[model samples]
Target: MKASSGYAGVPRWVLAIAIIGALFVVLPLVAMVVRVNWGQLIPLITSKESTDALLLSLRTSGAATLLCIIVGVPMALVLARTRFPGQRIVRSLVLLPLVLPPVVGGIALLYTFGRQGLLKAPMDFLGIQIAFSTTAVILAQTFVALPFLVLSLEGALRTVGTRYEAIGATLGAGPTTVLRRITLPLVLPALVSGAVLSFARALGEFGATLTFAGSLQGVTRTLPLEIYLQRESDPDAAVALALVLVAVAILVVGLAHQASLGNAGGRQRLL
Candidate 1:
């Protein structure tokens, strides 16, 4: 006759393992926070180099997020709404950056845009250079962050399905009309979540930007790169910057989660 606590049914071993997993992820963050030189935290993170890197990271990551949305949304729609030969392979390739090492992705970008790369002749003819520039930093971030948007939006599209789309067609709505009015509105929350996640990923990009763009303060030296450089000469500054990065990441992740919850709520209303 006793009232049950929902979690009481979970096995003790499972609960213990889950607690351990949470601690494993959390303890390092706690340790870093403990290591911070609190008295110098503001000064360390407010230095010229730190501010420059932080600004450049924000700029490039913003550009990268925009680029991801411009391209990733269409890619998601194609993957979710259509069937074609080699579709699985294409999706796999599109999502490759999610699993590939950042350094490897940077290498691939280098060979595609470097002076001696495949398009070298055309680039030289056009008097354009992409390597080791702010553009390169943006491209590197986009390369790695694109998959997050694509994957998120695609899953949402699949879950929402094509029933409403078909009905729109029967009601004399054209494809573009149906898409702009019905499909996009239904998936707006997912799109926001994906875009925020892409921004976070781009903000944290390091290995790819370093390998392709080369760190130059106020240019290609993003916060992550700045943190790495500071780690060699000023551990306090490095830790401070790392904490800043972690805070921004946490904020972005919270936004994504809220957007996801909104999407779930919207679906329930639809039901």
Candidate 2:
């Protein structure tokens, strides 16, 4: 295809960088596929422990994702739309977990919420024990995954703008009504993308989940934790579980890409 006069302004390096970036992203999956032993993959995937870890991964990751949406969305709204003292620091802090080592995050969680830690008195008073429990797994996942939701949603909120919500207010729509009828639909793609990213991260989370939640079968042992344990004793099962995680990560990226394309299409149609 010949470039239009306007399109001729695009630089060749931009295209080269994009191609390189795509290959970088895809190389791991290509390697995984090439390394997979198909004959034993199904058996490993179907084993009782594998199935339990997978089910636990799905359940805990799903719960953590829902918690992320419920909590992170409102925080994103505030961070994107509100101005206040310490706002810069708060925004940075909100994203701090993204930069923090997952192991450190788990240690931090333990220091704050572990049975003998800082909040132990109050937590115990409430009859809630955090460490070594399924709830602890969810909390650890949420801690590590929440920032993805907040950052993505905050970016989307910035793009969507508050103008529509203001218009809704001018039209006498209540805050809840305005959010549900105007803002949310506009930011839905971002929310979905963020949620999926959080879920993917949660599914693959290891260090933090292992440290804070502990590896207990049918309880806190997520797929990543199980895979790590299996890698030492059962290489085939480890590869099989790793493949499952890879498949899920691919699915999440695919869905995010499709949503973005759909959003672009909608914009083009509107234009």
**Model 2, 1-271: lDDT tens per residue?**
9664432576777777887999998897788777778999999998989999999999999999999999999999999988999999999999999999999999999999998889989998999898889999999999999999999889878876788889999999999999899888887877888888899889889889988999999999989988999999998788888999887888988887776666556545534
Q: Model 2: how far is 140 from its true place, Å? A: 0.8
Model 2 clash pairs are none
The runs of at least 3 residues in candidate 1 whose Cα sits more than 4 Å from the true structure, single-residue gaps closed, are: 1-8
Q: Any idea what lDDT model 2 has?
A: 0.89
- Write one digit per residue (lDDT tens) for candidate 1, span 124-238: 9999999999999999999999999999999999989899999999999999999999999999999999999999999999989999999999879999999999999999999
Q: Model 2: C-alpha RMSD to truth?
A: 2.8
Best by TM-score: 1
List lDDT for all candidates, in order. 0.97, 0.89
